[model samples]
Target: MRLIQQLIHQAVPDLNGRTFERRSARGIIVDGTKILLIYTERYNDYSFPGGGVAENEDLIVGLHRELAEETGASRTKVLQEFGYIDEYRPHHKPEYDLIHMESYFYVCEVDCDFENVQPEDYEIANGSYPVWIDIAEAIQHNRKVMANQEPSMGFSIARETIVLELVERELLGKASAV
Candidate 1:
């Protein structure tokens, strides 16, 4: 992990001494009209199954690994990169400087049965379950989760923006057709 961090610093010389900067990656796993979501035990909110990128790993590779680890969805093809979300949280204490992270979004196809899927060990440690819900239903449920339940659901910029980006692209495609 330390080696990867060093590599990242070498690759992106602009980053400061923030080796363990708070980082995350989310996999937008689409299966027909339904998308895969993970119901987290800790937060009791649902989001797409994916997690943080390793120290030196490429974003795409980390995304693939995360998706597979979370949803057992090994066969996935990344379709498009939807923008990114840059946010920060307090480091050790509220008085400290914020730890910044930029989460990249990718739309992808996966072939897995949501019901039978098992989250990998790390996901089990996080207490998450793979679930497939209709896109519209998932969005509405996520809104509720964000508003009333888990804060992560609503606070996840990557999840929110990725969905919006995909919807916007779809709408644009439709408009161009007419």
Candidate 2:
């Protein structure tokens, strides 16, 4: 997959010390101007419908699992790779100094009818739920959350916003002509 961007959180200390590496996969499912996303009420922001890949698990398999778990999506067919985002941030776990995350994104298609949605416990506590929202609206909402520095905002908002813009430009053909 291509590298879309690398982001270092402002709080990350400038050190090349111990780090924990994590790999995640996210899906981009679009229908006209709307996109399938996970809306976390606590954060008041949206994210892709996927999560961390388990050890030695195939990226696509993990993506499918995450899709089903988070959004009850089925019959998902991956169209193509949509690049990735590399991010570095302070780790919440004391075992690591920082966390280096590589998030892989793929363009995909899924059944319109969702069922049996079963998000992880933490996700449920966070009030995360699947939603189909306009791409521009999601982008604008995320940008606002970021601008206001919302206390409940999750770490993925910036990455999600950037990816949403890329989707708008490349997939939706909504980019401004220069």
Candidate 3:
């Protein structure tokens, strides 16, 4: 997969340790002028509808699982992939030091017969919920997030912001190249 983007921690210095690798699958669901997104007030940001791939789990299967768990989109179809994003950051904990996350992104469509979201404990606690926002609104929200003092899950926020811009340019018929 191509590296669509990379997000690195700004204030945190890069550690001189071996980078731990984590792989995940994400979905991009767009409908007309709005797009499906997962919002986390704890982080004050939005992300694509997807999650981490479990041990020995196939990427495709993991994607379906994540979509169901995160958005409850049962009647869904996976379209073409946009690409992958690489995010490198210092581990939230001290011992791990450097951590690199490779997230695979795909274009997906969902039908009307979708189920309720089954969010994780952290998500429920942190108010992670779904929303369909106008593309313009999403772009503006992303910009606001970028200008904030400190973003929770800064890597995810920064990368999502970039992806939203790219999506807007392509789908909205914007001439600006990503």
Candidate 4:
């Protein structure tokens, strides 16, 4: 295994004994009435602002780093962990025959200045375009644009899980109703 892979496996051994590998983390950054999303060509969906956890990096720290790297917003704060989603991709990485990844999701908060946030060039090339959408609209867009067969497949559940919970908790207020 590569050095980073070894370190990551060690860090998230919960994935041990599984058929596939890799663990990642993401955040649902809600700034007022707008939730931060990333447009990705790979997934062909609008999704949250987070990414994989680097070797030996703390999950929360990775969330912050990915948020900033992808969304250009460094001051965001994690409010609570929402849940985890599992995805199986046959050709995600050519090196591996298959990729089974578990992505941890968190609900986060950022100031209202996210409207002008910019995605990094590398991220953009990787198909990430930062956009803010109302929570309900985001959920609909995610369902419509995602590549999942089942409503719960891939990162689909994690996509709307946090938002639904937050809405139930009244964090999203009236915007939660769309």
lDDT of 2 by residue, 1-178 (tens): 8999999999987748789888999999999999999999989999999999987999999999998888887678999999999999989988889989999999999874556788889998989999999999889889889999999988889999999999999999997222
lDDT of 3 at 1: 70
Clash pairs (backbone) in predicted model 2: none
**Each prediction's number of clashing residue pairs:** 0, 0, 0, 0
- Whole-model alpha-carbon lDDT for candidate 4: 0.60
lDDT values of the candidates? Answer: 0.59, 0.90, 0.78, 0.60
Poorest 10 consecutive residues by lDDT, candidate 2: 111-120
Task: Give model 4's TM-score versus the native structure.
Answer: 0.64
How high is each candidate's TM-score? 0.66, 0.95, 0.88, 0.64
Q: Give the distance in Å from residue 98's predicted Cα in candidate 2 to where it truly belongs.
A: 0.8
The predictions' CA RMSDs to the true structure, in order, are 8.2, 1.8, 2.5, 7.9
Best by TM-score: 2
Worst 10 residues of 3 by lDDT: 169-178
Ranked candidates (TM-score, high to low): 2, 3, 1, 4
Q: Candidate 1: where are CA atoms >4 Å away?
A: 1-20, 92-96, 113-122, 149-178
TM-score of 1: 0.66
Position 28, candidate 1: lDDT: 73
lDDT of 1: 0.59
Per-residue alpha-carbon lDDT of candidate 3 for residues 1-178, written as tens digits (9 for 90 to 100): 7788777777448646767778899888888878888888887888888889976898878888888888888766888878888888877766677788888988888752235788889888988888888867776776677776553644577788778788778666653322
